[model samples]
Target: MDTQSITGATAAEIADSIRTLHERGELRAGDALPPVRELATRLSVNRNTAVAAYRLLAQAGVVVARGRAGTVIAGMEAVAQEGYAAGSVLRDIGTGNPDPRRIPDASTALAGALGRPVLYGEPVIDPALEQRALEWVGADLPGRDLRITVTSGAVDAVERLLAQALLRDDAVALEDPCFLASIHTVRLGGYRAVPVPVDVEGMTVEGLRAALAAGVRAIICTPRAQNPTGATLSPGRAAELRAVLADHPYVLIVEDDHFSMLSQRPYETLIGPEHRRFALVRSVSKSLGPDMCLAVAATDPETAERLSLRLSPGTTWVSHILQRLVLAQLTDATALQAVAEAGRHYAERNAAFAGALTDRGLPATAADGLNLWLELPLEAKTVADRLMRRGWLARTGDEFVLGEQRSASRHLRLTVHDLTDEEAERLIDDLVDASR
Candidate 1:
């Protein structure tokens, strides 16, 4: 289409016009949009108007700016998800799931959860869970005023937190090779994602500074056992980040401690005592089971109040029965012991896999999470393709990545804790063969 064809008086009008063209198949994916100055001249609007229009489109994931390459329409594929890929016959090692055998039996918890019926207008949080959660989560928080809010899972809590704190086109800083759910949440919420690189000690200081300089309104950090890479925030790095964030006290900082109970590393936080907006979320999925679908969020009083508005009575409040069941398990000595054993089990299995790969010269690091982020000499896709032929399905590091970090794609995130000894040995041999 010609530059004159893309007509609008305001940013929203221009954005709507472009979206209409996309819907009618006139502006297809990868098609370049006119430059801001050219578009402004053609539309008889200010250059800033054109910029705002493009920014709106970008936030909605309609088009991407490629610097010298200019802005082009983005592909509209469904967001990638975690868990098992459908119809794959190979022995899948990239499911990102905890071993089912390690999950504590919730039968007893369920029985305990069966109590008097809860009514509307009653407090949403289960009393016991709330009390235990405060003591558990409050211990790490630097802020004195902590209020807990319950959500479906870590993803749900993140989505809600972002929605409550930011506008559609506001910028949110996310780790480059971020968690799948976080990427999807930012995109689907129509917010701009500024990529922050993650290194061995979690999010790098320089990367975070750049993101903050870019004017990000919020940040989602994985403090312990970051997804895919298994990198935890070091104490030094955490302190550096806190010092950096100290200047931006009003920006919303969310710490998703998904592997809290199951992580082998010590917890390090970015939220400072003086910071005004922040939340620390702990989900029971890793230690208890995914089915529990519960996370406890400790946030500033104002943020908690805002979250409560979204999770109001007789509406979006999480199920009391579910909360009670999780509480039952948390308090049960046997279940707690099982959770500890599961943590150890994941560490041992991942370490063994990493050692096996290292022995063969790949030099893999086990870290803390369930998966091994193994870097190889060959391209991960090439190895994964070869592994598929040998009855395996592995996830490449690119799947979790945000921006152009192709070098990081050489690594694979494999879940091998549930594999039998023979299966583990076979996988090691097959991985070596695949790398060649």
Candidate 2:
């Protein structure tokens, strides 16, 4: 190794440099580190110095080494920086999102309690946080035998559940025009999402039956506020689905209640007691706040065991600080009220937009979620084009649906929360004129 090539820095100094690189995302998890000899030659450090630096990184949990193979960056979280290319803060009318300000401010008393060192070897899920989550879902869950698991978020829970229950090429039934994240997750994990039709009452039993007949091994259903459509699974429809799936006892059922806290509709779970395997995922992204990155995954004990395996100590775990903060906020009576009030506000605003559109002689559907899923008289693209000219951005329903027929439902998903009174009226007028 050429010792003079670099500044001949000390092993500790060399390690610190590498650590800095890791921290700044220059190196990432799963990236293979250069061989010690190669690194020493490049950095002009002694072979022993390079080895010592690598050893220090290993001890610090920043990297892991495999005998004879080599070392790789470890313990880093995956953060995908996509979609935000549109800018950090546009009017944000395109995304079906909740207000970050609506999240209850963490109490000073709770913040003061974190003065003690949060040791590295702590339990992945905090006890207090778990209890709070149980209180949140445990009360509403139809079955008494339900078990609880806290995931990083709804997406994390869905991914973990799919991993536990599905193999490559395994078929899962998902509502057509389902949650975009669900479609993407199944696709990335090499599973096929069989598109089931969603109707006015929510996921139709006939569509589910067809999906099951197509030999789907598992099902991912949204019980409340089906994404884009904002159709909540009604109790009558839920019972019908439970009966259809009753014969297919072996198939796993995963219900995503993404709008659980914000839902103005009735509570309807399709997981029957006799059904062997299932999971209930509730996310606070729409109500408490999207950035909170918190979700509760309630399931049977067996499913919980599998999910726990995915959330192992060295694997992905929700931050203790974040969990504590959410728990503190949720436990407070005033904080819960804030969440409730915010949910009502989103629903009211969304409904008002639908009413405004209807008043302007545009076809509109009143829904219970953060967005308005409108059925336009012309193609969604035509409406979107007209809206864009008026300085508005809207996501067409085509983006949310699956299959070859991406021409769309002459539908658009409008983020109604960001709509101002004048903007809302102008949009209605424009949509009416365009439809005609």
Candidate 3:
């Protein structure tokens, strides 16, 4: 240890030293370093100097402090995972993944529907598809005269909802670290975002109240399969939300149930019978296929009427052929079964990886959704970059944050896919190393 007073040293020097040490393998991810007192004494610096140094590392996403675990390096200088990055690079870890091998044999469904050239002005979303969508979603929804309106996908539905329910500058409450599309949807629409913090039980009631008091007029929440954190709202949490919104009857509440059909957690409806204004949206990208780009929006009658005006003139109505294909596949018992099986496969694989991690003594794997919500001893982005270097890419929590103080989290979002036991083990080992 160099006995040099860091009090007079610049922030850049401390950062440079940390980076150099990490690159030279003098420090490894998750490898705890000496305490601030020890490091400061060894470096002949004041305690504040050492604290500042560590703070620099944390800001740069180079290290983290885990109380008694002490301070540890944050991400890998090397190592990666196997999956595909749909854009930018060919990372091995897949995003928006569907079990390709598990997709319902589209051959029969496609063939049956491919023969017709439906004329323009046909049902933007085929009626058959809408009916099937209603049935699939209706099982979970009750008492509100629900009507289904299909759109290009979940994002499309969100955009349309925002267009109809809010105007520019209106405050829309969002989960603190929300889904990427949700963040983009609100921001692109020029709506202000009020972030509500989320915890294990899902969106915190206090946070929602704060946002409501702050005067947010619209809200978008994921009842299940919330992206990034994979935090699902518990029944109690839902009830809490209903209570908060009970007085704010005018707020436009939109629940994006993207993973409704495939969620591993038990279904819980956020809409209480007396809650008058709300919409429930679900997309089939993960289960049906991303290319299908179909999502259904079930809204209150007034909202439905307003949305219809937005839909009337444009081809924005979903394509008839595509809608028919979705309907055709959805109505088939075999196709539906295949989709169910695919969901099970995702749940199983994700659970396996999470279990493997827990079994290894890191037990924070219990959660829902398609990806593993992983908190590393390292910064989430650093782990992702390291994984990328090793030929894999994982989503960092930052990508989903909609707050003004947007910062990276120590959590990584990974979608587990077809991997042999050996591959899974290797992935975890690499992650452990990458975290180091």
Candidate 4:
């Protein structure tokens, strides 16, 4: 087809044409577009207009610029959303959930929260809750001018933060084996995810640097108990990442400390003190319960003000009662003890399971948080199939990968903390047999 028939004079028209071609499957994923000069000549447009057209396409997640390699189609297909899989007779180890038995009862706290009337137009966050949240989150953050915002959950806070700061198709740096919610939010928002590979010490410095060079507008990182991998950021690794990010002061940095009180490791961060745009989010779900659905966001002033636009009084404020309940549970001695004990329980159980696996001649180690990231000798799907046959269900690592690289992973994220001693032993034996 002639270039004039395929495209148009303006940048917007050219972008639309490319998008249409991609939608119609004519421009497949990884297919390179004609070079900027060639396209400009063919379309009888200025070179800058062609450049603008390509920039627009990159922003919309339709294509990616590979620097020296030229631009290629992104081919970002929506993976299956992660949540509770359908009911099965098999024991499910795939759900990345905390042990229910360990969750403290909030009945008394909920009753206390209901005693006072919470009228609209009152402060969005409870006064007492705000004080506690500031003190709690501020203790870990390095910034002096921190502002707090409360949202429905970590996912909510992240979505709002990105919406306020980024335009559609802006590149976001995300850990390769990313959290399910993070993946869903980025894809649904029409942003391209620049995959930053994660290791035992969290996101690698080189991976992050490369993403930044690719012009990522924002970064979302898990500082501890990273979902699916249970990887925590080490002190050394955190320092290295911060050094690299120092050059890009305005790039938004969001640290999702989802495991907060439940983690056995210390929280490490990537946001340097002088960093212009950043946020650290701590969710109460893992420590309290998922039903709580509360997260406190600590961010720079400008980001906080922008995030507040979406969270203001009338539109979508988190319930005051929930905030009070969280505050009550946080301060209550009994509840604190219960939460501490729960943390210990998860750590001990995971450690015991890892030891058992090691004793059985399998190389395994429990890292952190509610799940164990088990690396099997075979593909995770093969192991999952054998596990299903043996009446156990587990999440494979493939579901967590973002970007175009969809190679089968050898890892499986199993929430084995809820299993009894006997049950864990049997499962480990089954896993070993399955690998063979």
Lowest lDDT 10-residue stretch of candidate 2: 76-85
> What is the per-residue lDDT of model 4 for residues 1-436, given as tens digits with 9 covering 90 to 100?
1233458899999999988888887777888888999999998999999999999988777888899899988866656554467766778888888888899999988888876777877889888888898898887885568889999999999999999999898889999889989999998788878999999999998899999999999999999999878899999999999999999999999999989898889988998988999999999998899999999999999999998889878679998888989999999999989999999999999999999888898888889888888888889899899889998888888888875645688888888889988898899999889887
TM-score of candidate 3 relative to the true fold: 0.76
- What Cα-based lDDT does every candidate model obtain? 0.90, 0.77, 0.75, 0.89
Comparing 3 with 4 on TM-score, the higher-scoring candidate is: 4
Question: What TM-score would each prediction reach against the true structure?
Answer: 0.93, 0.78, 0.76, 0.87
- Measured on C-alpha atoms, candidate 4 has an lDDT of 0.89
Which ranges of candidate 4 are over 4 A from the true structure?
1-9, 13-78, 403-405
TM-score of 2: 0.78
Clashes of each: 0, 0, 12, 2
Write the residue-wise lDDT of candidate 1 on 1-436 in tens digits.
5345687899999999999898888888889999899999888999999999999888787888889999998885587688888998889999999998999999978987979998988999988889999999877874478999999999999999999999877999998788989999998888888999998899999999999999999999999899888999999999999999999999999999999999889999999889999999999988888889999999999999999989987678888889999998998999999999999999999998889889997788998788888888978899999999999999998888788875458889899999999999999999988898
Residue 346, model 1: lDDT of 94
lDDT of 2: 0.77
Off by over 4 Å in 3: 1-90, 114-125
